[model samples]
Target chain A: MIKTYLGIDVGSISTKGVLITENREIIAHAYLRTQGQPIEAIKNLIKELFKDNKNIEIKGVGTTGSARRLAGVIVGADVIKNEIITHAVAATYFYPETRTIIEIGGQDSKIILLKDSVPVDFAMNTVCAAGTGSFLEHQAIRLGIPIEEFGDYALRAKKAATIAGRCTVFAESDMIHKTQLGIPIEEIIRGLCEAIVRNYLGTVAKGKDIQPLILFQGGVAANIGVKTAFERALGIEVIVPQHFLIMGAIGAAFIAQDYTQKTKSTKFIGENLLDINFKTKTFECRDCTNFCEVIETYKNTQIIDRYGDRCGKWSEKLPNII
Target chain B: MKVAFPYLGYDTIALKKFVELLGAESCLGPPLTARTLSLGTKYSPELICLPFKITLGNFIEALEAGADTLLMAAGARKCRFGYYHYLQENILKKIDNRHCFYAISQYTPYEFFFKKMPQIFGVTPQKVIYATWLLLHYSALIDYFRKLIRLTRAYNFYDAQKKELEALRIIENVSSFKEVQKAKKELRKIFSPIINTSNEIIRIGLVGEIYLMLEPFANYEIEKELGKLGVLVVSKRSLYRHLKHLLKLDLFDLRTISNAYKYLKDSPGGEAIKTVGEAHIFAKKNIDGIIHIYPFTCMPENIAYEALQKLARDYEIPILSISIDEHTSKTGLLTRLEAFVEVVKRKKFKG
Candidate 1:
């Protein structure tokens, strides 16, 4: 009887899932576009993960990423952790000696500092969208190139063009200006990678203590040119783990395994939970003048979890989800 | 007048030393009790820092306790601390406590206190020298204590050093810089043997408007309080810092200077650059946390806030944002401060 653990990462742009066996082998994994429907995406993820592993008994379930709460409610996730914790845990579990983590996703960029397999500090770029994968994707479409070929084109460049990468506004204008100057496409692509790396250095990693033994994970890790740019900028090699894109899901599974082993009870609502109805609503709280925007999760008529209240006034009314 | 001075910058010793020098008795509010927070919260509107609420609560308590004058420090430039005296005066008037608010002007209406020779215990020069000496001692003590707290690995050992330093507040004879220096040296010597002086604890740079940083009543005195929880704070005299910023604004072109560059985009003041430079320095130092404070509706700080967040991300340090205004409450501010401190501590210990 191969014992398995389920992990789900429900993010704004994508929902990812992974099923791991007792030996920490990824038995099943699935990636699906969330399309602004986390509930549906998670249901689809669970459906795909359970497609082949009919005999595999799930010991526990974990959820991570931005929409962890919503995923938790939908998937009956036993462990709900933040992306920073989940990513660091996964990186450390695999590499063991990972020090810095450079995670650039479609919508966000994060720099996680770790010492001895534990997260020391982390910085996430939520306000600025300039150095993220979506920014590169937008630029790639504008440059008449597929996003996948971006890395190869960048590597082929003999000389780099200077692209203003401070903000999207500045970058667009500067990119157009550089194009007007008749820079080669390869040079421009290389310049884009450099600009991203430079922007990341100037913003996300500004005051952070970025030591060596860095791990680059996320959708953007597939880009060799960006990886090269990071290596050049930091003068250090970045290790991209085998399961870089699904590391969050893997980390969640690992956590689930660890947690369920101790609790000895499967809190998972089971795969049949896909049929449950759920909705998320956000409202501004007028309590105490902070006006905290509280996000509420409802299962039909019953409220499952309410968060985003900075003072924990509204969250206090809900169950201890943490 | 049996004046009551809410401890803002520095610590109990700084207030004690000042009270001792003034030859005037002070109605010392209890050690930032929960009651103090409630008072602020009850009276304060939302959206202001916790420190402001607590201070107002302390003021209300002091007035009820028969204290007439509330000694405070004022500033100038874009930092909202400059308007503290003016705003507080109005708030108090509306509350109708009728207590005379005698602020020790650090900048705004700077001439009103120094040049006009405001009376203190019927002695002008004596008050001036006394205030100056106390300020110097407080500045030195804060710098040393924050460093000490950060460097020490053993929590007990750090507490021991703090206890020794705090014990000096009861002494009423720090009338000169010589006395202040003596007190500081003795305290440092007591801490030298105990604190892990070798370990450089993560030094955080708190760059923003001054009011929310210095006035515990405004930002919940988070810096010093964080020190109690083993996080060392680095902050200069709020008034002095803002004054230098004002001089730079007058001297440099509003558009060219980096310190006030943010202000240049909207207005022509050098305060924005001053804030940016400070944020840059903090980032460059690779400080563990950069807790930025700003007053609500403060345009210059808002500009700096945008730039600082970017810097925080780039520097890889934890940054906490705090906005203070007339409506801010003490409890709300304290909760944020607690969370911020907890995050920093968790990160430090885990790392």
Candidate 2:
């Protein structure tokens, strides 16, 4: 029997899962759209990753991302960590000499500056979604270009046209105006890519050291156009890891491996939980002026988890696995 | 006469007591809610700072509650705070012309105690002095209560919260200087059972604009949330200290200015010097991290942010600077804080 661990990353836009061995070798991986339903996506993700690998003895489990706590409770994870540390851990693990990390996901863009394999500083895009995968996708759809082929158009342009990128509303109007002025489609696409790179540097990566050995990952790493723009802007080479999309899941598996080594046991319920009747209910808690909307998760008629209260009056009822 | 002032977190009670003792009925604005922010935003300029909008909301609510007079603290230089009252009053006048509006200008002790407050309240100068003195002492006592609660919360959060309310009740009704010290001692006793010292706790210092630091509604009750996360938050910026600084009696403020001089040569604007100063002090204390919070679009805090980057580099400590506004989402804020705390915790354990 193969001794393996499970890692699940349920982000805002996508869900990714991986099964890895004791030596940190990925045996199986799956990626699927969360589609605003993280629990369903996670269950389907587990089903896909575990295909024909039933003989594998899962030793541990971990979860990360925006819905990390929900994923943790569903899968009974051995380790639950945020995406920042998880991404940093996986990046530094693969590239020991990495100095900076530029991660642009579906809705969030973050720059993590590392010194000697430790995250010395980090900043994320706050109050702005002007430059992100979702914005790029929205623009792509409006321009009649598939997101997968959007980067190819940018590479084909001879000279990029200028477009406003400080805000999505301005960027959209600029793109429409350029199109109305009969500008080449490729040049406008390239300009949008450059605009995103400029916006990221001006806001999220502002004042941070952008040294060499930079690794650019997250869902947006697939865009060769963005990679080129980053290189052009920073005057430094950017490298995307082989598993850029699943790096966060891999990190979770690595963290779970580290955790179970100490605890000597895994909290993973089993290899398959698709058959379990999982349900979640939410209600507004009016106990205080801060009217928190509390969430309760149930499994087969038994309450498993409750959270989302600021006062912890409901969350603390069930002691955490930690 | 019925009097009202904008809320300043837990110091509202202290202010209430001050007004009541001045031979007037104290009418507090409604507790800050979503409606307060909405009302303020609706009546305010598009680009005004958050304090203005919130204070305007407080005044509006207080007026609705039959408050006859509204007092706002004024007088600042190199900052927009000094201009909030002038704009707010104009908006309020358009809303309703009958209510009395006043800006109690700072940096004028003689005019404040001898002329302004006495004339407003129909009180003697000696009475005003006594009331102001009690206000200072009440805040000092409340600040002490907060310190004990923070220490206790880091170790025992639930108990700290339970005892905090009980202790505040004992604190709010203290009528004399004799009661102040006795009340503080009682607060200590109430929280003593939960105040366990542990080297394992995470220490974070909070520094930012004075309004955001004092108003829980403005910054979203950051101290309590951090404490619940088992973080020992050290925030020294309070009304108690501000009063001392105004009186030219705070030796600590003198040291803060010198420390701030290491990075900022001169004040760029509001709270910039103090924010940089407090952050530098926190880094020197070798805490786990420093959380810098200020309203979005604040100029001085923005200037201080640049200095803090260098400070973070020099000290090699994690600094989380959060720019808050009405639109700042709760989930997004919580996510950042949790991630930061986890990173800081790992750094400590790994070292």
- Which structure among the candidates has the greatest lDDT? 2
What DockQ results do all the predictions give, each relative to the true complex? 0.09, 0.53
- Using TM-score, give the best candidate's number: 2
For every candidate structure, what is the RMSD over all alpha carbons to the true structure, in angstroms? 11.2, 1.7
Tens-digit lDDT string for candidate 1 (B301-329): 67776776666555656676666655455
State the lDDT of candidate 2 residue by residue for B1-351, as single tens digits. 889999998888888899998999988766888778889999988777888889998889889989989899998788999899899889999988998899998889999999999999999999999998999999999889878888998998888888877988998879999999999889878898778786478999999999999998888888888887889999879888988888787899978889999999899978899999989999998888999998888989999999998898889888888998888987788778877887778777762
lDDT of 1 by residue, A15-124 (tens): 88999998999989998888888888888888898888899888999998777877887667789877777788889988988989999887778787776676655666
Model 1 segments more than 4 A misplaced: A207-209, A286-290, A310-313, B1-104, B107-210, B213-351
Per-residue alpha-carbon lDDT of model 2 for A1-322, expressed as tens digits? 9999898999988899999999888899998999999889988998898787878898999999888988998889999988888888889889999988899998999988777887767888887988898899888899889999988999999989998999999999999999999999999999999999999999888777688799999989999998999998888899999999988899899999988999999888885578887889999888766677899988889889998887678988888544
Fnat per candidate, as a fraction, reads 0.15, 0.31
Once model 2 is optimally superposed onto the true structure by TM-score, how far is the C-alpha of residue A32 displaced, in angstroms?
Answer: 0.9
lDDT of 1 at A106: 76
